[model samples]
Target: MRENPTASADRDTPPTEWSVDVPETAAGDGGSDVRTSNDRLLEQYRRRSRKKSAVIVVIAALLVAVWGYAVVTGPIPVSLSETVSVLSGTDTGTAYQVIWNIRLPRIVAAVGAGAGLAVAGAVLQSVLRNPLASPYTLGISQGAAFGAAFSIVVLGTGTTSGSGPILSVIDPYLTSVSAFTGALTSTTAIYLVAKYKRATPETLILTGIALAALYTAGTTSLEYFATNTELAALVYWKFGDVSGTTWRFNALLWFVVAAVTVYFTRRAWAYTVLNAGDETARSLGVPVERTRLFGMVFASFVTAVVVALFGIIGFVGLVVPHIVRRLIGGEERILIPASTVAGAALLLSADTVARTIISPIVLPVGIVTSFVGVPLFLYLILRGREYW
Candidate 1:
């Protein structure tokens, strides 16, 4: 019988890269090279893991240093022991009051906001698969701004004294309530629009841009029709002040930050699998849509709480996570935790500069973060576009 030409040609063609190879070892064991290759890859991962751990430790140390600087800093420099004394309730008088009543709360709020925003940014970036998605970058802050403005100008949630958005003696957070509602409203609206349009990770960018513009217009309209008192209230609140933070507010924010961070970290492995592509993730048994939805909601919740407490601070999200990624690489296990620490450090440093830069006249931390972030983000884009 004549040989089949098609079978001959098929046999003649070289095997594809997907072809399996099972080589025998000198000891007669099969597939030793494959095992060796996998072993080598695992070793590489281990080395990288150790280095990542070291980097996190260093960043954590830096965060502690920055926190310390924030504490003892101000017009009257405080000693570490003095700070400890006030914290321990052993100290008394002027030093104690300044550190305890004012400085401590401010420091706590800055750390909480920075850490929360940064972690939120990291989660959003991972889940959305977009390098630029963050509360501030994607209009969460604008939504929050509108919400807060509505409370102050539309709902007349401004303090009864009518000077500003200060808490009344009886109602410590009349304005805060409306702001939270506004934030959640913004989050839900954006999520729904994106979902209705069947937005991919990429198309959601447009969703954010459109919503930001709409919210900004709403805020502007509110401002235009406001009374003088309401306008001043709205204006100051929009500046993103942490100085107004009470201990009660700080406790609430810290609790949210802790809860969200833990939740995100626990899901880091799923997020890592997701980076391989949704189909690959599904093959690995990941619940792609549900995880994405939960992540967005939780991240938005964290951002909303921080925004409500601190006004509309930005950039900690946009800048910190990117920097952490560049320094450490994309594995979410490291990225999430390290970003949290770096974020706290970066914001505390920024807050320090904001307080002292134009001495006796503190600028809003939001402005400072913008100044710091814009230049840095520009540099990153220009210099390391490949990294993204």
Candidate 2:
């Protein structure tokens, strides 16, 4: 049998009738008026919560549909069954090579990167208590971009290819490593400065902006020194396309995405408490400052790894979570996963359009997302007349 959630709360509430005339609506048919108002409101919320859960399930189904669409419709449209056959190793020849070696990896990378950015944004918004807070808001993307540029332009780690009498294939590993290091350094700088002072929203955000400006200047300097070939490569990477993702990089991206999602999802309760404000969180025995620091740092790590592999996709961390919050409520349990799936779908869809819209002259996935997000975000805000 289903249990009544408000039963215990009703029992626990003290009589309030002697103090003031109880509102007629406060009492139930059972005449249990003591806590009926609050209990009834909570029950109403529970009903709405159930509805939101159903919505989340539907959103998850949409993610699957988007994934299927991504897999089948490309430059050479492969059927879903054929794609499955290729994956299952029952198919052979050029079809398998094209799907497995190219389309599949890029699709997977797009989904993973989008999901990672969305989840990271959710975490940052909760911790920072700022609607605008995101991976980019804290300068993490710029830092990662600067690092990738350093490796690409200064070190020539991923750009020394298809030139001269002898082709030189630059090791992609060094570029990834440098990008990670630069991202970590920027994040660590923010964390350290915040810890030394206080990890308040204002302090962390200010520190991030400063670091972002520094990184941007450094990147500009690097671009000034770079040869035309190097500059072109750097610009392409910064445009945030997921076209040339190799199996090795895609594998690592998936690993990080899985790990980050699991970590954040498990800490869902802590995030809820944190969102309630520092004093309330402290009252609930949550380590407010430490939790905020961990959330920001890990979120930054995910963003860095993604930008390292896929370049600097913006507004994902900023837009997706807000969209999730708008569609679903801000309960961490639903918000995190829903944002992730929605984000994955958004990016994969954007990447698909990027590849096909202009035909051979593929646009960057980032550009597509930005073009789409700005209008959608405005619609959401204008329609609601309330911030997410």
Candidate 3:
């Protein structure tokens, strides 16, 4: 036993090769705290998504209700029951004439115009990274105004017997066509500056400002030399009334709005990426410049169509998208559609108030929207960077 010291030491020493047996829970779950935190985050996201969906549904319902109410509330009162009956083709009387001929077209125009402009504003704001970007702010509306003014003053598309709301356009088509051409001209200018000069978003806005001034000057100059009748007609046209829009015009407007809305919805993810910043978006496989340019063009096109048809309904685009963002976060997929519906509601509601606010005197929807929009725009400005 004394001679076998090595064997004795080997028997006393522990084994060098050993393996740890990790618990299945720890291996599968990583760690309990980490797993719980991940689950909480996921749940929060889902809850937020659900809340946004709920808000959208509420807005859609509001739109329908507002539409019905608008059809009923006009110069000649029509009950909701009568409204329903007329729509169902069960009764055709003064209510039918009012709903089908006058109120329906105007109300539909408001909805379509509002939705189109609002979606355009949301897209422009996202792509340009400018919370204030809108058809009115970007000079597209002003361009349309100028085009309309040109039609009235130069093209003699409008006429008036006396200085009153009785002013009428001789050829609505020519006026709209002229307005579209003007809007296209302004859009083209912006595109060129963006493409050739490599303008920033801020620069493009400045270009818009300059174009607006140019168009305004042109319009003012035309008004200066116009006859009294022409002046009256021009002034009324700038008020932005949907009361005069025909069914044909509404059809065209809704078609454009629907098509543009679809395009925006499909490309919403791209817009969300763009909102993250141009460089970040580029890194994420987005064609930054092309997307920006196309976004501006499409947004401008929809805006142009609406303005051409309904004159200039301001702040529907600017105010609506911001309101939607506050409700749903910066998720464009929801933001675009929600803004569209919300915009329709806002404008329709405004139009309804405009009709009844003064009883006999119907205020221009443009005026009402401005009254609302100006305060909100100022508030957003005061809120500074956080508003976005």
Ranking by TM-score: 3, 1, 2
> In order, how many clashes per candidate?
0, 0, 0
Determine the C-alpha RMSD for candidate 1 after optimal superposition of all C-alphas: 5.8
By summed lDDT, the worst window of 10 consecutive residues in model 2 runs over 160-169
Task: Give the lDDT of residue 38 in candidate 3.
Answer: 64
C-alpha RMSD values across all candidates: 5.8, 7.3, 9.0
Q: Model 1 off-target regions past 4 Å? A: 1-40, 156-181, 184-203
Task: Residues 176-284, candidate 1: write the lDDT tens digits.
Answer: 5565566666667656765577666446767777778888898889989988766665666677777777888888888989999999999999989888877899899
Q: Please provide, for model 3 over 1-388, each residue's C-alpha lDDT reduced to its tens digit, 9 standing for 90 to 100.
A: 5677764678778567768733333334557775666666777988989999999999999999998788889778899899889999998998999899988888998899889989999998888777878887778888877887788788777777553664566676787678777877887787688668867766887998999898888888888999877776667767787777788888888998899999989999999898787789999999988888888878877887777666788888989999998888889999999999999999999988998899878887888999999999888888845844
Which regions in candidate 2 have their CA more than 4 angstroms from the true location? 1-46, 160-174, 188-210, 376-388
Which residue pairs come into collision in candidate 3?
Answer: none
* Cα TM-score per model: 0.83, 0.80, 0.83
Q: Is candidate 2 or 3 superior in TM-score? A: 3
lDDT of 2 by residue, 230-314 (tens): 7767667777888757778777888888898898999889999987877999999999878888888788778877887778898
Better of 2 and 3 by lDDT: 3
